[model samples]
Target: MNTVRSFGFLAKKILLLSLITCWGISGHAQEQRPNILFVISDDQSFPHASAYGSEFVDTPAFDRVAGEGILFMNGFVASPGCSPSRAAILTGRYPWQNEAAGTHASSFSEKYTVLPDLLEEAGYTVGYTGKGWGPGDWEAGGRERNPAGPAFQDEELTPPHDYIRDTDYAGNFRVFLEQRPQESPFYFWLGTSEPHRAYEEGIGRAAGKKLEDVEVPDYLPDTPEVRGDLLDYAVEIEWFDRHLGEALALLKERGELENTMIIVTSDNGMPFPRAKANLYEDGIHVPLAIRWGEHVAGGRVVEDLVSLIDIMPTVLEAAGVEHRGEYVMTGKSLMNILTSSEEGIVDPSRLAVYSGRERHSSSRWNHLGYPQRSLRTHQYLYIRNFAPQRWPAGSPRRIEDGQLTPMHSGYHDIDAAPALEVMTEQADDPYFNRYLHLAVGRRPAEELYNIKKDPACINNLALDPEYEELTQSFRERLRGVLNKTGDPRVAGDGDVWESYPRLRGPMREFPAPEWVLPVKED
Candidate 1:
């Protein structure tokens, strides 16, 4: 009887030990799941961040992220405009893949899945502050919240400029963290609506920024007006960076810094003429910095091309989630690139990056877009203008309420600003005519530029005899990828992009340009 009692005690001890070991393993798995923080700024371009040695903007927070992890030199967005760019990032697909969401001021379809939605399904508490997936409506798609996530934008503060919004982005992030379940990880999108448009006149100069300090791009005139506008742009960008610093501090204080993956980037390029709405280097290229604490090595600069669409797959992979949907993603995960210790061209397969633009604003005939697509290689940029006859910057004049506006008055594609006004006023001057032409001129069907030699894209090489073979090769490659990815523009159903409903914003009428007036049935 004594030996039997001893055996029973031994059996109970073994069972208890086994249960504790399983619990430990489960906790270890939880620890491996890192929280994600995606920070995006509106209307910002690449080479503007301090890490890239730009003298214009001071982005210490972005630099901090780069110092701790990696700075991507060739980060490109799917679209040069805001709405489609955000849609592409959220859905992990190109803008053309999303129905109406592919254009500006349209609706997002319910068919495609977004990053936050997928992360939520995998047990993450998701939320967003400031700008998210918009300039478009998400409710029309039967979505419960913005595609970025739920809102956390209650807090506000007085802003330095009337153009700048007052949403307390960092404070809202803290609220999100506080309200989340202790055991569940969180995914937050801190999108800032800074550096867009309607900036306070002379704000940059008022802030003591020297006009000489502003480095004017070759496409714009180097006058005090343009320089002052650039300075004001810098002020707003810094405001976005300030909030980023606060958020980083909050995460560090909560002891969640090392366990979180932080990604910093922008929707597109700066809100300047010939930059924001075009497919040039300044329009599609954007700053990207990532930090994952001990998970990634610090102070690495990668030159490989990466697109914004990759964000969705990278986050999904990090959380061990699989995208098993019918709407396939064309982007590959950056996990391999992120984890690698190599600096330049970590992935040779990333030979090039692509970007495009559809209807950016209501600035065309029947709301028609200046449809353009581009392919950027290590040394060259190739552009294809589907409708070359349409005014690239909208018709030079518009008819409103049965009245015709004057010539050189309705280049609505360029955002209304002091710099734009200055350029228009000086358009006839031989000295400034070239700058005007670069901004509002009608483009050729095909344009090729050696990006290294002409970053501004002022010189076209498509018709040059020396670059004929290279131009043909790029054109073929671009078309092949577009076909493989099921892009409608290449699939003989390109008109469907125009068929998408513009659910919001005011519509305007445009008079046909001289090139198309002769063909008009009128």
Candidate 2:
């Protein structure tokens, strides 16, 4: 129960989450409260940054943030997948409550409270650049806050669809700042698109990156191709960091850094197998750093377990604003933690931190996913695969044009590793070889791992007799929360999604499963 804070016995688990988990929110807001620079990167992993001790790619800007403020070593996203993770960060509610935003293709419900909108209400100007609130739309929920800001009147700029030059995030951010209302405290989300995907192969090599400089995750095999791909990923990461540097430098040049609370972190785990789309540490764990001048002590590293939902409550606290009682927020400020005012975080009794994924990428048919849920704590991590019968990635079908069709094929953790690459490539037919065990393989419905012993989560302790004690406890913990969260399947169970009026879209028409697809009558 070593956590930031915890509530007493509540029904259905009371949406257990922690504030410490949300990345960013470093400095003191009072000194710098109204001016908030929230920067988020897509699909970047913790191991890529030098601040976290990555020798491969040097992220001086990211490291600078950590150096100037506080670096959270135990930060986690409520839901490891993107859409839901963003929803939790903004709304401070678990994905199940934000049902519309729960899945990849689904839209975020307008009924939820978005942080930017609240900040605007509290008299702060707000706007965003590049990859604001998506993978899906939020307009369907009947709210017109496209980026959900009453303060969002400035020009809107999104990142490039394909690679481009100076026209990326920083340029668009400049446009936002130039158009911002005069003499008002402004909140801007500088979301970067540098490191997501579709990089020109060997792009990093051309940039003078060395393969030996690459750091490989234990889950993936060490090989030249994997290292090279990692280097390519590193190049993009550096590009993103440099953008952050430029933004910080701009704030300083404009006399804003000292009074600006800068919060920077990634959306979810690295975009790799057993990482991005899964609920393992590699998926949910992220790097977090924050800075505030003369208030939040610099050079602090806290290990208290925290979750994304706590963001709203913390930011609200920092901004000297309350939740208005009309809206119930699930997060608390780590202000005390940052200031080291509290002796030690009370066993926040974070019964567990939870995450799930509904869909990813273009291949899923019938919208049937690798559907999964997981719970993480200091001792162990437990996962429940709702649809163990389905492939984690889309099935064994050959993707149309690119390597990305098989989503797991390019996972940075295990993506393109020599073992996976050669094993897949040399096979007679790509349809069977490409996806292989990475997807479409049968798996146990319940999995338990000793997170301390196996951080990568490679060992399945659920079925092992030696770990039965650990398995039972973890299973019970997950079941209690899921049932409390009103997950239908666990309670003799039904689908909570069934109670929800399922949103309709062309996404529902994903290719039908082979068994269900009719042989063409033609």
Candidate 3:
């Protein structure tokens, strides 16, 4: 019996070895292992590109990619925040499954294997330029390099505006291509730090962009300040897209365009008060376009739900590499959805998608996390906030050096921007108070919304008797999946997320809410 078991184990190992050895063989060698160029923009949201019919911003490069390949309408990130969302994309797992890597600005554990490391082992030359898997300490996590790859940021260029980054992303990419060996295939990550925050006021107008072209979201007022902010965001989006066009042109100049797979998307949503950190549609939904030349069909629009984490497995499969890690991937490959001739809903089984959040900025007392999990389908959206007692954003005002700010002042979770500043200054006004309430108000544990009717997620349907059954069904489905995936939130260890040390960002002190008194011990 012992001999038979030994023989079976050895046979399995040999079969795996044979599969790995066949990666670069015969006619399929170069054809199967195509180069990967992944371009990511910071804080851009869905329907922002010209291809998506937005009149505000013109993204010719993104449109060109869509014209030459597939355009996705239902693509989302794993988290609403940057660090954890990037970590999830690299590891191909949910944020809750990865220990410290799952939290914002925390160290990533080396125990979890990332896509670049796995591809490097499979003989692919991997590297990255600009911002990659960051805003956190990767070195403290025991990684000798950035999880994305080696750095190639030796070049610089003067940006159009003062707030924009001077890192010449396109020039750096060209440098990387020049340095790479001719015979070896490469995986390059082009992460652009654009459209994030602290925009030079009225720079968009200075650049000849009209404020009237900006389409304000329903959650925000249609004031000039809001329109100006949106225009500035649009300007930055165009800047990033311009670099993408240059990179695509470079690939064409080198005759690698046809064989290379180009993926263009963003890390998270726009940097607005309620959009970037909240689990609303604008927060999680992002723009996505892919161009694979002749390997995949062009001018295709797909409506199937896809997650950012799916990129890890999709790239691995494209390189003819197999996954052999301890942690399991929660995302499914989009190869079938991409290769099919159909336009929308190629996979009916992809009925719903899931997303979760751990911690964003250090905006609260004790750095406590307002953990949330959500489920999105074609018709409806459901969300569960674990700590309903805690403020959804942060406290109204923070304390410093024995000074006190007035009521409705803090809301630190919301990023500081012109629109946010306007909302804060005009909080007492009748017209702006409703919008302000939506951005920083507390709520029930479970909230539901009809996305088709309320894409902004302003109305809560969980307590509506008309949709009681539907809400209950979605709530159970969300909890069941979390339990199945061993989510700590439902696995009796949800508090572990709060225990993780926040290694970066300022730690602000906030007074206890005037409403809640201290609990007395028994």
TM-score each candidate.
0.93, 0.81, 0.93
Residue 106, model 3, lDDT: 92
Which candidate should be chosen as best, given TM-score against the real structure?
3
For 1-522, candidate 3 gives per-residue lDDT tens digits of 132343244345434634665443334543567899999999998989999999899999999998899999999998888889999999999888888888899999888889887776566667788899978999889987789977777788888788899999999889778766565677899999987887888978888888888889999988999999999899999999999999999999999999898999998899987788888999999999988988789999999888998998888778777676579677788888767778988899988888888878777777877899999998888999998877877878778886767776667778888888787789889788888888887868999999899998888999889989998999899999899888999999999999998898888787775446687789
What value of lDDT does candidate 2 attain over all alpha carbons?
Answer: 0.65
The lDDT values for all models are: 0.86, 0.65, 0.85
On lDDT, the stronger of 1 and 2 is: 1
The ten-residue window of minimal lDDT in model 1 covers: 1-10
RMSD to true structure for each model, in Å = 8.6, 9.5, 6.9
Model 2: worst 10 consecutive residues (lDDT sum): 2-11
Candidate 2 to truth, TM: 0.81
- Inter-residue clash pairs, candidate 3: 396-410
Native-vs-model 3 lDDT? 0.85
Question: Which is better, 2 or 3, measured by TM-score?
Answer: 3
Determine the backbone clash count of candidate 3: 1
Show model 3 residue runs off by greater than 4 Å: 1-31, 514-522
